[model samples]
Target: MTTFLLFSFLQLAQPSAIQFTNQDLQLESNSGYIQLDWTAVEGSQYILQRSMQPDFTNSHTIYQGPDHASFVSGLDNGTYYYRVGDDEGHWSDTLTLKVEHQSMPLALTLFGLGFVVFAFTVFVVIKGVYTTSQS
Candidate 1:
């Protein structure tokens, strides 16, 4: 009798009208920042939260807004988990974002190549000098 009553109550409850979808997580340029976004929920305000660990041992609220976009800055260079909740108590599935502090620019790549060549030349010169001294 109790089980039937519980089932009937569950059926009577209405689901959340505000639905979240199309969650996207991405990095912001070369900075160690992450951006969490999702499909706009109708008639609701978005609440964004982030966590450093998979289990969400430490969670932080990043944003609360009705806008379609949100940006989170000063993130670590690793993976982060985020979730969105609407004002109507509808929460979304967690999204994962990856942030990279250093992106290899063309100029930086060329500079690195130049430094490698210079280092090799210096090493070769030192080796030659040592060999001559030994002889």
Candidate 2:
């Protein structure tokens, strides 16, 4: 009698809807890469697509598996659009990612600053050594 009651209750329960976390749907940008992370549902495969245009007419699938995150690198500086979907055809809202690579002028300025600091440090060390020897 107890086994029968437990089975009846289990069957009456409804499973909750599967959805991705809002926070996890955001796009993350780094120096040389862009990453998309999301909460994955069990037994469901996700499809990730990207395109340079907002209409996604030329979008291409970058990943189609059961992974929780995707990464893209070596992309030129520009705006990109991304969207994620499940095998069931349920797609999340579109998100935008912007990439800005470092320019050559900025790189040269940083290199010049580093060289100046290094030269000053060497000069300070040599002056201290000469003074100690004379004393």
Candidate 3:
């Protein structure tokens, strides 16, 4: 009876695993933001950590609250590592994210094309109104 009780007590004392809800965690994003989510335990707050290294060296806590999801934005283009942990210090497996935004030249070209289209549309509208009123 004592052995059984001891084993049960040990089991209860051990921390539960923190698992990320996103199974396909390795992904790339062209956007500047991402939503990080994980499984949450009722009545327990969680800690969200981010690091540049996959090994979690020099990791810093990005969030610590009861919320299970975090919206992270304005991230520069690079590789990022994230992990979620419970208040008891049980950490989940790391997730890797790669951010590669569109090139500046491409963005500028799109803008110029848009401006040209706008100018052409305005010229056509003005010419049509002038011809109708003159006739």
Leading candidate by TM-score: 3
Listed per model in order, the count of residue pairs whose N, CA or C atoms clash below 3 Å is 0, 0, 0
lDDT by residue for model 1 (6-84), tens: 9889875865433334434443345765445577845668888788886667888778888756767777677887777
Candidate 3: where are CA atoms >4 Å away?
Answer: 1-14
Worst 10 residues of 1 by lDDT: 19-28
Whole-model lDDT per candidate: 0.71, 0.77, 0.91
**65-130: candidate 3 lDDT, tens digit per residue:** 999999999989999999999877888988899999999999999999999999999999999999
Higher-scoring candidate on lDDT, 1 or 3 = 3
The digit string of per-residue lDDT tens for model 2 on 4-110 reads: 98988886563323343546444545465766776676777888889888889999999999996887788777788888888877676777777777888999999
> Residue 17, candidate 3: how far off, in angstroms?
2.3
Model 2, which residues run further than 4 Å from truth?
1-32, 124-135
Each candidate's TM vs. the true structure?
0.52, 0.67, 0.83
Pairs in clash, predicted candidate 3: none
**Higher-lDDT candidate of 1 and 2:** 2
